[model samples]
Every structure is written in structure tokens, then in C-alpha cells.
Target chain A: MSQGEPGIELDTSLGYMLKAAASALHSAMEAVLSPLGMTITHYSCLELLAQRPGLSNSELARGAFVTRQSMNVLLQSLERQGLVIRPARAPVGRALPTELTDLGRRQLEVASAAVRRVEQNMLADLDTDEQDQMRRLLRTCITSITEPPASTT
Target chain B: MSQGEPGIELDTSLGYMLKAAASALHSAMEAVLSPLGMTITHYSCLELLAQRPGLSNSELARGAFVTRQSMNVLLQSLERQGLVIRPARAPVGRALPTELTDLGRRQLEVASAAVRRVEQNMLADLDTDEQDQMRRLLRTCITSITEPPASTT
Candidate 1:
């Protein structure tokens, strides 16, 4: 086949850069969280529950960018570790709503502080205006990617 | 323990927003690439090889944000499929360098175009200046996360 258009120039590709930034952020978060005996996904699950208590397993999976099965496994481990709890049965549906336990909340406190510092460090160089602009820009990109693709015909 | 500082406000946290954007972009890429029979990591491996031929397994894993073991598994699969090749023995060090075969390059062409379209869609609303700003912003964040932690004393 005809040589495909020159492959995306990695240096200038926004998508590549986005992945790089995300990867770096993930590694940094892991470095801090691991010492606290938590993984990034574990921390995310607790944080999501704190902000929006009783999120279902599937919801946490979506929020954490992991498969439902993986989240289910994590939830099980968290439950065993006494970090979160779920009713023996779903109160209203098949989705068992989850919440942080006292132990979980206590654990989250230290991890949250560490995580906040990581985030603050990440944005230490950007001013408030620039941070806002970055937020808006990121939201725009997210919308474009998530929205239905336009007619190509 | 004393109540830790309030957890990061999910809505306003740049780090959270960055993860959201990256997640969205990844899902979008997967949607398009899957029909082409490529997972996001698979596509990333091919793309990286095309851009920087002879990347070692560990390097590819780092670039793809996967563990070295995972990358090794994928490399074995790709090698079996005749899409990539490595010498029977390392030329010098123990790192066996990988190169894409002609078939691999052709496959990458299609995947690259699909990925580029996804990236373009993500940036459809941003002007050149805004895109440049985003690039700069992402680079700065990546650097901050990767660089050694500043002295806390």
C-alpha cells in the first residue's frame, strides 16, 4: 500500500503529549500513594465515594478508567481491608452501592493530603488564569472526543 | 488523627481534569482502533516503533505506560504474527532492539491515520495559539511530575 501519511510527529502531537502528562501524573501519584499502602485506583475509588457516596461498582470503574471486573476485584480487596463497605444486598438494584468506612476515610485523609500536594506541585508553575485556561481547554478537548463524530460524507 | 485537609475538590482539580481528558482521549482512540483490530497499547507500540525504530522492550513499555512484563508479552505476540523482529541474540547489551516489519509499517499507517483523526477531533475547537499553549502547559506538568521533588526543608 502507498506509504501511509508520515506517522504522527510524536514531538508535536497533542495526543501523545497528553498521554505523557497523564503517565507522569500517574507515576507520581503511585510513588506517593504506594508508601501509604494504596494504589492510584484504590485512592480514586475512595475519593469518588467520598465526593459522591454510594457510587456503584460500575460507576467507580468508569470513574477510575478500569474495567468493571477489575473494580469489582479492587472493591472486594478494599472491603476485606476494611476500607469500604457495601450492603449484603443491593437496596434497590443489582448495583451494590459502596461507601468509605471510618477506616477508609481515615486512610483517605493521609493519602488525600499527599495526592493534593502532588496535584499542587503539578500546577505550581501555572498561574490561576493559566490553570483556568488549561481547564477550559481540557474540557473542550474532552467534549470533542466524547461527542458523536460529525458527518464525514 | 486530626482531620486531614479537605480532599481535593474533584471539579476544580487540574490533575483530575487531566486524567479525565486523557481517559476520554483513550476511549476515543480505542473505539476507532478496535475495528482495525488493535488495542490502544498495541497501536501505541506500533506507532512508537514507526517513530523511533529500534526501541527496546523496556523503552517501549515506558512509552506505552505498561509494565515491562506486559510489553514483553505483547512483543512475543507481535513477533509471532510477523509484525516485528528482533535478532536472535542481543547485538551488544541484553536489551534486544525491536524493529517493525513491512507488514507492521503498513498496519501502522492505517492505525496512525485513525489516531491522528481522533487527535484532530480532540483539537477541533482550539486555535493554533491555544493548541500551542496546551502543549506548553502539558509539557510543564510532565516536567514537574518527573523532576526530582524540591527540597522540603
Candidate 2:
């Protein structure tokens, strides 16, 4: 159906709107990042590693909202590019700790600028207040879903 | 950086927040839909087809925010499941038209209820006003990016 059709079949719930906006924004991001030979998923992993030097695979996967298997595949790809390095082993555990290499750091610098440009272009219509409100609402939603319930005691 | 770090390298932009929220919501959706043997991508395609019976592959891809190649793979899978039927030729053009089968409509009915539960859980915290505002802002963002500029006479 077209935009103004009566009784459109799609449910205009908050989740549906969020999914549509995210999908559109993701398409824009992929277009922007494609020239740099990075998918948004790759960039997200690298960005998280840049900020946190020695995150375990599970930790990174959790932060990136990807499954551990998917994260492992992404890590392997980054490693193959020599942009990320995994240390031999963690001091306290058997887990492998991943850190961005110097090349990866520089790449992040470039990717960050590209991402910022895309973000600005996407949000050009909203004033600062509206933007802030949107962010707060999203954060609240995320926290409510992710946090565990308090004990009844 | 840890949460207390003075300068954590977070993007904190509207696009970033939107992406993060969408990612989390999608993961939740996938978890709920997996037992029913459906990815969100597949469910989306089925949903659109159920609503509009004769959508072309390109039109479905555009509505679902996926590449034509990806859409082709998904359609093949759905057709194999006996949920979708693709005509060899369309009245308008050579491009094929696809519609949901009887099984597809029933699948969608079941999946829609599960999806609604996940969505309700996600939005359980927000009051009605917050939910409305969230939907309005997200719709505005989607429209701003997707809509072409007005023609200058």
C-alpha cells in the first residue's frame, strides 16, 4: 500500500518504527562505509576495541549485539587484515584478549570521521533538544530490556 | 574505557543511538522467532507480501531494506517452504511478482503474535505519551532520509 492508504496492514508500533528507521540508517551507513572496505559490523567491532584495549571475544560480542560465532568470524577477518591482534593468552584465564593494532587505530581514526559525517547527515533535520530526547528515550528502552529485575526482598 | 572513564570513545549521536537500539531489538526479535524457523528478514518479507499480494522482488527488497541478491536468496528459501509463490511473468513487466500462499498467511498470523509479544516487552516501561513521541520521531527520521526533496517549479 501507498503511504496514506486507509487501514494500512503494517502495525505502526514503536518497535516497527524503530526497525524501519534503523534499517534506513543502516543502508545509509553501509553506503558510506563500503568505499573503505568495511561493513558496519566490522566497524563496530573495531570501534569497541579501539575504546577498550583488551576485550575478550564474548565481551566484545555482547557489546556489539552479535552472537559469539558471528563475532569470532568478524575477529578472524580483522585479524586476517592485520588490523587487530589477539594476544597469546590472558594472564588469569584461557580467554584470548583482542586489541586493535596500530593500523587498526589509524583506520578507526578514518572510520570515526566517516561515521560522524554520516551521523550528522542523518540527524540534520533534528534540533539539539529533539536529538537529546531521542537519545534518552532509546537509552531508557535499552536499559529496561537489558537489566535484570530486582529481588522481591 | 570503563564506564567511569573520563573520555570514553562513544559516538553518542542520534544515528548511533538508533542503531544500538535497533540492534538490541533485532536480537530480541530473532530469539523469539528462531523457534518458529524464521529470521526477521524472512518474516519481514512475508509480512509485506501478505499485505500486498503482487509485489515484485525489487519492491519487496526496497520495502525490507535488503539488497536484491539477498532478497533472491530469501525468496528461494520461502518458496521452498511452500509459503511463497512467484509467477513466471507479470502483467506489468518481465519482473516476477510474488505472493504469500495459504501456508504463508497462517505462518504470518502465528509469527505476528510472537512479534507483538516481543514488541510489547520492549515497550513495557514507557507510558503511552513516550511511546507516541518515539514513534513520531522515528517516522520523521525515516521520512526525512527516504523522501526526495520537493521539486522546484
* Fnat values, candidates in order: 0.73, 0.58
lDDT of each: 0.89, 0.78
Pull out the clashing pairs in model 2: none
Chain A TM-score, each candidate: 0.91, 0.86
lDDT of 1 by residue, B1-153 (tens): 122336977777889999999999988888889899999999999988988888889988987989999999999999999999999998877888899999999999998988888898999999999999999999888888888778531
Q: Give the least accurate 10-residue stretch of model 2 chain A, judged by summed lDDT.
A: A1-10
lDDT of 2 by residue, B24-140 (tens): 788778877899999998999998887777777887887677888899999999999999999765666566878899999999999998887777777778888888888778877
Off by over 4 Å in 1: A1-8, B1-5
Q: For all the predictions, what are the DockQ values?
A: 0.49, 0.42
Question: Which candidate leads in lDDT?
Answer: 1
Q: lDDT per residue, candidate 1, A1-153, as tens digits?
A: 112435458868999999999999999998899988899999999998888888999999998889999999999999999999999999897999998999999999999999988998888888999999999999999899888778461
TM-score of each: 0.89, 0.84
